[model samples]
Every structure is written in structure tokens, then in C-alpha cells.
Target chain A: MPILEAKNLTYTYSIGSPFEKTAVDHIDLSIAEGEFVGVIGHTGSGKSTLMQMMNGLLQPTSGQILLDGCDIWDKKTDRRNIRFQVGLVFQYPEYQLFEETVYQDIAFGPKNMKLSEAEIDRRVRETAEAVGLTEEQLKKAPYALSGGQKRRAAIAGVMAMEPRVLILDEPTAGLDPKGRTKILTQLQAFHKRTGCTILLVSHSMEDVARYASKLLVLSQAKVVCYDTPTGVFAQSQSLESMGLALPQITRIFKQLAEKGISFEDEVYTVKYGAELLKTRLEGRNPEC
Target chain B: MLKDITLGQYFPMNSVVHRMDARYKIVITLIYLVMLFWGQQIWSLAAGLIFTATAVFCSKIPPKMIIKSIKPIVPILIFTGLINLLMLDGGDVYWKWWVIRITEEGVQTSVFMIVRICLLIAGTSLLTYTTSPIVLTDAIESLLSPMKKLKMPVHELAMMMTIALRFIPTLIEETSKIMAAQKARGADLESGSIVQRAQALVPILIPLFVSAFRRAEELALAMECRCYHGGEGRTRLRKLQSGLRDYIALAITLLMFAGVIVLNAVLH
Candidate 1:
């Protein structure tokens, strides 16, 4: 069964008014356990609106959100419990930090879950370790930390809840390349270590290509395509027509293929590209 | 539910009222209010109503929108009318029950008070509905430009109002986003005790306040980068012009007020 499922979800803003707009229109999505799904779209394509609906933060205009074979919006189901089970880290989450100490901020979710003191401490420490935060760093105020640290602390706050499903909206936005890679690597490691389902909403095709196994493309408030990253990237012409582009590596590889230099495997990451080049070079000059 | 708020809402249209000088509209509105209050006797009240109703028609604003604007203050209107009805004791009593007396004077005073308040609100709403906030503030600043010689800070006041009006919807949107973010973390904002709900707002308020400060700092930097130095040498793109329609509007307002005054004198 899927960890999270949205069936025919729709959201309309400013309904019954002259400025009314339909943001998300009848989107159907199903995310299975341990799957990292990447959502890509142009700005105002309703990606954030769909993310908010999955965890019950937004009630859909019509349709249902089912988690673990039960409707998340069921009257018998506790909406808050669904929230705890599905963690969401909004864009620029560092702006949401308000607690005096990093440790207290990270422990907020576990505390709200009514866990025991020792359990909360254990979860907080584990989350801090997962996000590469030092014990001393936890003692300081969140506002006093550097921007990257603040972001990690905010992500750790969601991780401490131990949710089975995690949704991140532009986790690497406004970050340096090193910082972006660090956060994405840490998220990938967390997914691998805990086997949790993850949904990442991003506009960067390269980031989505490297990190997500499945891909969903949105355009004009509708799902244009939903498939594996390779399948989605193969339709580069259609994506470009919609004012979008494929990952940088994918474009390079496609050019190489057009020039009659096909490789055995598709290379999406720098490491994979380097490996492919090394093998080709060894075949040309074995002594060197 | 916050979507229903139409305060300061600008409707874009190409009507005669929308094209008039906002400063003149403001002056005419003041004159209309003065005449409404100056009205006495049935003929004077009827004349005032006819003038207001005609402006309402020429403004091209939907009649229902004016009704919605008057909807919010209904409670206060009802309260004032009821108080007048219950308290006036000069005229002959029509009915008495349990120390509550209904008198002819009380009834007349209640109806007059209701009409006065209704006309007052309806007249102002027409101005707002027809004029955009930027135009309105610019008109106000222009009208008050003479006070700048008295060190009244008219430019700064108008600038502040413009900034506030621009940010109201942006901040409302930011607040809703913050509220959703907090709610996603198991923060129960709804279905809570009043105190609990107020407490739940802390999570939202902190982020909203932080973003507001961030926006202000960014705006300051942007203004400095653009060499902004207040309204010292600013020129308007659309200069306020007093055309034939403006003259006609003013004449009608004055003639209506004069006719009411004459009727009040003759009838009394």
C-alpha cells in the first residue's frame, strides 16, 4: 500500500470572488513506502498546494488523502496524528525558528507528541546527529546560528518526530552549492537509514534527477507527467516547450548520444560521469 | 473565510466616477455627509436620499456591494436605533409595558437615526469602491500638500498609508502560510479553547513577525539602492483634472444641499 495517496484533489483560492483561481486541479498521486518522489513545476504550478494537502494542513476542495489505507480526513482519524506521521519542512524553514535554544527547538515535535522526557531527549540527539549538528551547537540559540545551521536545526525538528513520510519544499533554495549538496546528501542518507518515504518539491532538475527515483511534473495546475526520472527526462522536448529544461548531465549525455557516443548506463551524477569517462579512457590507452 | 474582506479592495473599470479626481470626490463626499446630517423634515430627507442614490447609480458600483459594506455596522445601527426608541421621553406615550414606554417622539428619533447612519456609510463606501487606494492616497496627499508648509509631514503620512495598504494583503497571505506550516507540525489551531487557540497563534505570530521585519529591512535596502529620497521631487503620472463631470458632480451636491435647506426652512 502507498504511504500517502491523493485522489482527485483540487484546491481553489478566493472562491466565490472575482479574483478566484484554481491552484490544483484534480491531481491524483500515490507515494509508496521508501520511495523518494520529486515534484517539479514552474512557479505557481500548485506544487506547494499539493504538498500541504498530503499532511492535512490544507483541506482539499474535493477528494481524499489516504495514509496507510485510511483516509487522513476521516472524522474518526485524528488530523494531528496524521501531521505527526507525515512531516513537512516548508521553504526557508529557518525563518520558522523561535525557541531560545536549538535543542528545545529540535525537541518541539517529540514533546508535542507527548513522549517521555528520556524518549524526547533520545530523539532530539538522534536527529541532531542525523543532520550533522554538534552537541555544543544544540546549547546555543537558533537565531544566533549561521543560516545553514539554522536550516539544519529546522530540518532536525521535523526528523525528531520520526515520521514515516517526509515532505520538503525546496530544501536547498538560496544555498551555496556545497551547502545544497550537504543537505541533499544528508536527506538521502536519512531516507536510506530509516527507509521512510520522502517527497521533495524542487524546480532544479539536476537535484531531482540525482535524489529522486520517481518524478512528477506539473504545469498550469495539472500533472503533465508522472514516471521515473529517466522516463520524465527522456521527454526533454515536451518539458522545454513548457518552459522547463532537463538536468544538465542529461542534456550533455543526450548530445553525446546524438554524436554516436552511447554509453552502457545513464549518468546523472558527477561521480557516475567520471566513472564512465575513466572506463572509456582505459579502453583507449591501457598502459597509461 | 478571510477571503470575504473587501476593505480597500480596488475594482478596475473605465467609468466616469472612476475617472474623476479623487480629491474632488473626497470633498464632494464631505459635502454630501454634511448635507445628510443637515437634513430635517420628510422633504429634506427625501432630497438627500435622491442625491445619494443618483451618485450611487452614476458610480457604476454594484448596488449589492454597497449593501455588503453596510452589513458589518448593522449591529451598531440597530443598537443606536433601539436605544433611541427606548429612551426618548418627551412625546405622548403610545404603549407602556413593564416600565418600557413606546412614544411617538421615540419612534421618530429611531427612524431618523437609522436613516442618518445608513446614508453616512453608504456614501463613503461608494468613494472607496470607485477609487483605488494608490489614487486615493495620492489625492489625499495632494489635497494636504498645503499643510506641508506647516511641517505636517503630509508626504510621509501618505507614504506610510501607501506602504500599509500595499502590505496588508501580502502579510495576510504570509500569515496564512505560517498558520499552515504550524498546523502541519501538529499545532491544533481550530477546535481548541479560546486560550489554547490564542496560544496556538504564537507559532504563527513569531514567524510572521520575523518575515515582516525581514521584508522591511529588504525594502529599506532596495529603496536606498534606488536613491529614493521621499516625495521631494516626485511627479505624478496621472495629474488630477477637474473636467465637466467634476463640475456637474459638485453642482448637484450643492444644489441638493440647498434644496434640502430650503425645504427644511419652508416646512418647519
Candidate 2:
């Protein structure tokens, strides 16, 4: 069974007003256990709204979300528990950090879960280490850290909860290239080690292509595609029409293929493209 | 859920009231409020009500929206009415209690106060519903331009007002976002005791303050980059011009207030 499922979820903003907007409309998808799902869309295509609904932060106007075969919106089902189960780290989550120390900030989620102080301390330190924060750094004020460290601390706050399904919205936004890579690589390591399901909402096609096992494309508040990264990138034309572009490497490979150069259509990452090119070069120049 | 707040929010629509100059609307609203409070007699109050109802109809704003604006102050309305009903000790008593008495004059005064307050809110809300905040600020600045001679910094004040009004929606959106982010971390804002709920606000308030400060800093930098020197000879794209409709609105407001004064003199 899917770890988390959204069935016909819809959210309308400013209903009954002139600004009424259907932010998320009839979105149906499921995140399997240990799957890293990438959510991509145009700026106003309801990616944030859908992510909020998945964790019960925003209630769906219609339809339901199911976690572990039970409706999360069921009256008897504690919604707060669902938040603990599905961790949502919003964009620029560092702004949400309020605790005096990074360690205390990271302990917030586990404390909310009513864990014992020792357990909370253990989780805080463990998640902080996983996110690459040193012990001295964790003891310092969160505001004293650099921007990237603050972001990692904020993400560690959610991770300390040990949520089964983690959802991060543009976790690397506004970060420098090195900071972005460091955060994403650490997240990749965390996912690999814990085997937790993750839904990463990102604008970078290349980043998603590299790490996300599955890609979900949204356009005009509806899901246009939900499939493996290779399968989704194969529909480059449709994705472009929806205001999304394929990964740069995939586009370059496509252009090469169109110029009478035979190559696989599913090359989405630079590493994979380089590997393909190296093999082709070795085949063409046997001496080299 | 915080989005339902429509107080001081402008609803854009094409209507005579909306097209009227903001200065005229503001003046007329002030005059209407004065009439509401000055009209003490039954006939004057009735005239005020009819005037407000007609203005509401002409504004073309939904009556439901006007009622929604009044909903937040329902408790105040009841409190005032109850105080007037029990405290006013004139005319024949209909019911008596330890410290509460319902007399004819008390009932009349309570009804009068409640109706006046309702009309006051309805009239003022119509002004906001018709005029956008930018236009309103422009009108205020233009109207207060004469105060510049007194070293009052009219332009600076108006600029500050406009900026503050503009950030209301932005701040509200930020607040909701911060609230959602906190809630996602299992910060229970809803089902807590009074103290716990207030304490829960710390998580939201700190982030809101941080982001607000960041936004202000960024805005200041952007403004400075664009050479935004505090309202010194800044020309507006849309100049406020008074038209025939503005005159008509002004005439109606003045005539209503004069008519209420006359009716009060004759009836009471």
C-alpha cells in the first residue's frame, strides 16, 4: 500500500470572492514507501497548496487524504498526529526557527510529539548530525548560523520528529550553488539511510531528475503526469507546453538525437550523459 | 481561515460610488457619520437610515458584505445597547430589577444608538469598499497638502500610510504561511488552553517578525536603489480629479446633514 495518498483533493482560495481561485483541483496521487517523489509545476500551479494538504496543514475543499489505509480527515483521527507522521518543511523554513539554540530548535518537533527529554535530546543530536550540523554549532543560537546552516537546522527540526513521510518545498531555495548541493546531498543521504518516503517540491528540473525516483507534473492546478523520472522526461514537449522544461542534459541529448546522432532518450542527468558520451567515444575511437 | 477578514478591504467594481473621487467619498462618509450621531429625533434618525440605505444601494456593494463587516462588532453593539437600555432612567418604567430597569426612553435610546452605530459602520465600510487604498491615500495626501506649509510632513505621512496599508495583505499572507509551517511541525495552535495558545503564538510571532523585518529591509534597499527619496516631487501615475459625480455625492451628504438638523429642530 502507498504510504500516503491524496484522492481527488481540491483546495479553493478566497471562495465566493472576486479572487476565488482553485489552487489545487482534483489531484490524485500516492507516495509509495521509500519513494522520493518530485513535485514540479509553474509558479502558480498549486504545488504548495497540494503539499500543504498532504500533511493536513490545509484541509481539502473536497476529497480526502489517506495515510496507511485510513482517512486522515476522519473525525476520530488526530490531525496533529498526521503532522507528526508527515513532516512538511516549507520553503525558506529557516524563518520558522524560533528557539534560542539550534539544538532546542531541532528538539521542537519531538517535544511536540511528547517524547521524553532524553529521547528528544537523542533525536535532536542525531538529526542535527545527519543534516551536517556540528555539536558546537547546534549549541549556538540558530540566528547566529549562516543561511545554509539555519536551513539545515530548520530541516533537522522536522527530521527530529522521525516522520515516516517527509515533504520539503524548495528546501534549497535562495542558497548558493555549494550550499544547495550540500543540502540536497545530505537529504539524499538521510533518505538512503532511513528509507523514508519523501516528496520534494522543487523548481530545478536537474535536481529533481538526479534524486527523485518519481516525478509529478502539475499544470493549471491539475496533475498532468505522475511517473518515473525517465518516463516523465520523455514527454518533453508536453512538459514544455505546461511551462516546464526537461533537464538540460536531457534537452542536449534530445538535440543530439535529432541531429542524426543515436543516443538513449532517457538521459536526464549530467553523470548519465557523460557516461553515455564516454562509451560512444570509446566505441568510435578504439585507439583512444 | 484568516482570509475572511474584509475590513478596510477594497472591492473593485464599476459603479457611480466607486467612480466618485476618493476625497469626496471620505468627506461624505465623515458627514454621514456626523449626521448619524447628531440626529436625535425619530424623524431625523429615520431620515439617516433611509439615506444610508440609499447610499448602500447606489454603491452596488453586496448587502451581505456590509453585514459581514458589522459581524465582528456585534458584541460591542449588544453591549452598548444593553447599557443604554438599563442606564437611561427617563419615561415610564415597563420592567424593574435590582439595578436594571427597562423604560420607554431607555428602549427608544437603545434602538436609536444601535441603529446609529450600524449606519455608521455601513457608511464607513462603503467608503473603503469603493475606494482602493492607494486612491484613498492619494486623496488624503492631496487634501492634506495645505498642511505642508505648517511643516507637517504631509507627503511623508501619506507615503507612510500608503506603505502600511499596502503591507496589510502581505503581512496577512505571511502570517498564514508561518502559521501553517508551525502547524506542520505539530505546533498545536488550536486545541490549547488560553495560556498554551498564547504561548503557541511565539513560534509564529518570531518568524513573522523576522520575515517582516527582512521584507522591510529588502523593500528599503530596492526603493533606495530606485532613488526613492521620501515623497519629494513624486508624481503619481493617476491624478485624483473631481468630477460631476463627486459634486453630486458631496451635495447629497451636505443636504442630508442639513435636512437632519432641520428635522431634529422641528420634531424635538
Candidate 3:
């Protein structure tokens, strides 16, 4: 069964006003349990709106969101509980940190869950370590930490909730290349260890290519494609038509294939492309 | 939700009112306010209402936008109306209670007050609706230029007002973003006691304030980088020039105020 499901969901902002807009228009999708789903969309593609709906932070104008097959929008269901169950880490997460110390900040979500003090402490420390925050670092004020550390601390705050599904909206946005890679790799390792359903919302093809098991693409407030990375990347023309720039690595692979040196699989990341080239040079079925 | 604030939010439209010198608009709005408050009798309210309605019509802003401007002040309007209705003491007594009594004169005074207040708000908001904040600040700076002789920091004041006005929407957006982010982390802001709700706000307010200061610093750096030196040699692309339309508008408003005064005397 899908852990999080949105059915015919539509959200119209500023209704009955001059600024009325339909952010998410009749989006229907279900995310299965323990699946790392990559949600790709340009700005205004309704990906943010969709993620907010899954956690019930934003009530859909029409339709329902089911968490564990239970309607999250149902009056009987506690929306706050739904938020705890489906954690969302927004872009520039560092700005959301407010507690005196990193430890307190990370403990915020678990504390709000009304957990035992010991459990809150355990989750905070564990998630802090998972995000690579040292004990000394966690003791320091959140503002005292470096940019990447603050971002991780804020992400750890949400992860401490131990949500069944974690939705991060451009978590690595605005970071340097090294910081971005560090965060992504840490997230990848965290996902591996926790086995939680992760919805990584990003526009960067490289960010999700290596880790995300399934790719969900949206354009103009509607879903264009939802499939494996190979399947989604195959529609190069359609994706480009939607204004998503095909990463340079994808182009290189395409050029190679056009020259009749086709590989068995799509090469997304430079590392994966290198691995594929090595095997091909060693004479193991270069042409698919 | 914070976008509901319509104060200082300009409605962009091309009309005589919008095209008129913003300084004149500011002066006219002040004159209209004075007319509303100066009137001692109920007869003057009709004149003020008519003037405001005419201004609204000339501005060509949609009635919906005007109504939205009134929505935020409805609470204050109701509170003031209720206070006037009960507290005022005069004329023939219609109903009597222990501490609160309704009198014929009190009812008249309350109706007069409510109408006057609405027209007052409508008139002033019409100025903001027709004039963009940038133009409005430039007009103020031009009007206050003479004060520079007296060592008044007119440029600085106008620049400050412009910055404040410009950031209203930006700060509101930042606030909503912070609020949403905190809420997603299971920050319970709803269905709580007053104290609990206030406590919940800490998460949002801290981030909002931090980002606001950060933005201010960034803006300051950006301004300095572009050689922003306190308006000494500042040259504006658009200069405020009073045209025939402004004179005509002022004359019409002055005539309406005179008519109201004459009507007040005739009624008495």
C-alpha cells in the first residue's frame, strides 16, 4: 500500500480575490512505502504545493490526501499529527532554526510530539549525528554553526520526528557544490539507514539521478511523467520542451549513443558515466 | 494570509486622479480628512461622502479593491460605532438602561460618526490607491524640500518611508514562509490556549526577524555598492509638476467643503 497518497487534489490560493490561482490542479499520485521518489518541476509546477498538501500544512481545495490509507484532511484526523508523520524540510532550512542550541533545535519536533524526555534526547542526538553534527557542534548556538551545519541542524530537527515519509523541498538549494554534495550524500546515507520514504523535491537532474528510485515530473501544475530515471530521462525532447534543461552529462551520453556507441543504460551522473565507459572500454557489450 | 494588508498597497491604473501630481493628491486627501473631522453637524457627511465617491470614480480603481481596503478596518469601525452609540448623551431619551441609554441625539451622532469615519478612510485610501508609493514619497520629498533650508533631513525621511513601504510585501512574504516552515515541523499554532499560541509564535518570529535583518544588511550593502550617498546630488528621473488637473481637483474639493459649510448654516 502507498504510504502517502494524493487523490485528485487541487489547491486554489486566494480564492474569491483578485490574486486567485490554482497552484496544484487535480494532481493524483501515490507514493509507496520506503521508496525514494524524486519530484522534479520548474518553478510554479506545483511541487511545493503538492508536498505541503501531503503533510496537511495546506488543505487542498478539493480531493483528499491519505496517510496510511487514512484521509489526512478528515476532521477526525489531527492535522498536526499528520505534519509529524510526514516531515517537510523547506528550502533554506537554516533560517527556520530558532532554538538556543542545535540540540534544542533538533529536539523541537520530537518535543512537540510529546515524547518522553529520554526519547526526545535520543532522537535529537541520533538525527544530529546522522546529519553529521558533532556533540560539540550541537551544544553551540544554531547561529554559531557554519552555513551547512545550520542547514543540517534544521533538517535534523524534522528528521527527529522520525516521520514515515520525509519530503524535502530543495534542501540543498543555495549551497556551494561541496556543501550540496555533502548534504545529498548524508541524506542518501540517512535514507539507507532509516529506510524511510523520501520525497526529494528538486529541479536539478543530477541531485536525484543517482539516488532516487522513482522520478515524478510536473509541468504547468500537472504531472507529465512518473517513472524510473531511465524512463523519465528518455523523453529528452518533452522534458526540454517543459523548460527543464537537460544536464550536460545527459547530452554527452546522447551524443555518444548517436555515434552508435550506445550504452546499456542511461548515464546521469559523471561517476555513473565513468563506470559505464570503463566497462565499455574493457569490451563488455558497448552497444545495447 | 498576511497579504490581506492593503494599506500603502497602490492600485495601478491610468486615470486623471492617478496622473495628477501626487503632492496634490496628498494635500487633497488631508483637506478631505479635515473637512470630515471639522464638520459639527450631520449635514456635512453627505457632502464628504459625495466628494469621496467622486474621487473613487475618477481614480477608476475597481470597487472590489476599495471594498478590500475597508475590510481590514471594519472591526475598528464597529467598535467606534458601538462606543458612540452608547456613550453620547443628548436629545430625547428613546430607551433607558441602568448604565447604558439610547437617546435620539446619540443615534444621530453615531450615524454621523460611522458615515464620517467610512468617508474619511475611503478618501485617504483613495490617495494611496491612485498614487504609487514611489511617486508618493517623491512628492513628499519635493514638498518638504524647503525644509532642507531649516536643516531638516527631508530626503532621508522620504527615503526611509519608501524603504518601509517597499518592504511591507517582502516582509509579509518572508513571515508567511517562516510560518509555513515552522508549521511543517509540527509547530502547533492552532487549537491551543492563548499562551500556548503565543509560545508557538517564537519559532516563526525569530526566523522572520533574523531574515529581516539579513535583508536589511544586504540592501544596505547593495545601496552602498551603487554609490547611494544620502541624496545630496540625487537627481530624479521624474519631477513632481502640478498641472491644471490638480488645480481643478483642489477647486472642486474646496467648493464641496464650502457647500457643506453653507448647508450646515442653512440647517441650523
The residue-level lDDT of candidate 3 at A126 comes to 92
Sort order, DockQ high to low: 3, 2, 1
Clashing pairs in 2: none
Give the per-residue lDDT of model 3 (tens digit) for B150-254. Answer: 999999999999999889889898889888998888787776899998999999999888988999999999999999999898897888889899999889878
Which 10 consecutive positions of candidate 2 chain A have the poorest summed lDDT? A257-266
Can you tell me which runs of candidate 1 are displaced by over 4 Å? Answer: A14-21, A285-288, B89-104, B262-268
Model 3 interface CAPRI class: medium
The number of the candidate with the highest lDDT is: 2
lDDT of 3 by residue, A6-61 (tens): 88989999999889999898988988899999999889999999888888888899
Model 3 spans with C-alpha error above 4 angstroms: A282-288, B33-50, B61-119, B253-268
- As a whole number from 0 to 100, the lDDT of residue A28 in candidate 2 is 87
| TM-score, predicted candidate 3 vs. hidden true structure | 0.88
Ten residues in a row with the worst lDDT in model 1 chain A?
A264-273
Q: Give me the displacement of residue A253 in model 1, in angstroms.
A: 2.0
Give the DockQ-based CAPRI class for model 1.
medium
Considering only chain B, report the TM-score of each candidate against the true chain B: 0.92, 0.87, 0.81
Residues B157-238 of candidate 2: C-alpha lDDT, one tens digit per residue: 8888888888888999999988988988889887769999999999999989988899999999999999999767798789
| lDDT score for residue A21 of model 1 | 91
- Looking at candidate 3 chain A, the ten consecutive residues that score lowest on lDDT are A279-288
